[model samples]
Target: MVLSYMEGFLLGLGAAVPLGPINILIMNESVKRYKNGVIIGLGAMSSDITYLFLIMFGLMIYVNQPEILNGLSLFGGVFLIYLAYTIYKNRDTKIDIPIQQVAKKSSMKLYLKGYILTSVNPYTVGFWFSVSGYIAGKELNPFITLFGMLSAILLWITLMPYLVHRSRHKISQRVSHWISLVSSIILFGFGIMMFINLFYN
Candidate 1:
């Protein structure tokens, strides 16, 4: 269980460390309003864990049935393209908004946003299912594997906010925009890969 947990945490870190609109939003908020930035990152992180839990709990098995994976792949591809277009269209907008006292949105809302964003990609679900399946196939305990997965999510959510906060200001705005663009391209590539896999398999 300990070994599995460490491996899962490392996997989660690798997945979350990449730059995206969510990360950009976190960074943007952090530079101007520290607390809210943390909140946004927390939201994304929470969402990721929720997806992790869903995958661990056998939701993917159901989703993978009856060509649902194919549907997911198609939807994910379109979603990526739409996200890319939106980002490209708004690439020049200055995002530095002034901070003000406001009612705090529930953490549940943040968690759901993160969860839904992560859940949109069927490939991700498939990947997790494969990992868990491998362990179960090898006769490992499902409960322990779940604990490991949870550990990974905890490590990611706990550290990502601080990392984003620390690094946001060090990079130039142009650089940040470029990073976001690259992230979009990567997402698009994943979408394409998922589409191909859906048909090839």
Candidate 2:
């Protein structure tokens, strides 16, 4: 069981380590409003935990239903396309908004925004679901595996802000713009793959 938990944790870590839209949003938020940023980060982490729990309990079986999987893929692909545009539009943007202004918004609202943003990412949810199903044969306790995965996700969220904070100086506006552009491209690629997968596989 211990080995199983470790394996699950490592797998989850590998999946979550990739820098995506959520990470970029966290970085931007941290620079502009540290407290709200942390809350948002925590909310995103909470979504991960929810995904992990669903996955551990055999939720991936939904993907085997062709109709459902196709619908999810279509929805996910469209959302990715929209997200790509949003990122592209913000390529030249920086964190200039005051914390006081941000603070006027309720914390719950910020939390919900983060939660919904991460939760709506079907590819991310599907990835965890698939991974959980793959490892289900190990006979490990689901809760233990979930705890491990959540631990790793929380650790990543806690550490990532500091890394972003430190590296901000080295990253110029041009570099940030390029990074957003590249990420948008990557998202577009993923969207294409998902669209193809919806029909081909």
lDDT of 1 by residue, 1-201 (tens): 666656656555655556654554454344434565556556655555565577767675576664776776677667656655655564554433333543354666545444555666664566676776676676655666556655665555556556765666576767767755665666566657766876787
Model 1 ranges with Cα > 4 A deviation: 1-4, 7-60, 95-113, 195-201
Task: Compute each candidate's TM-score over C-alphas.
Answer: 0.65, 0.72
Q: What stretches of model 2 exceed 4 Å from their correct place?
A: 1-5, 24-44, 55-64, 95-126, 133-135
Candidate 1 worst ten-residue window by lDDT: 94-103
**TM accuracy, model 1:** 0.65
Q: Rate the local accuracy (lDDT) of all candidates.
A: 0.59, 0.69
Task: Assess candidate 2 and give its lDDT.
Answer: 0.69
How many collisions between residues are there in candidate 1? Answer: 2
User: What lDDT is reached at residue 113 by model 2?
Assistant: 53
Clash number for each model: 2, 0
TM-score of 2: 0.72
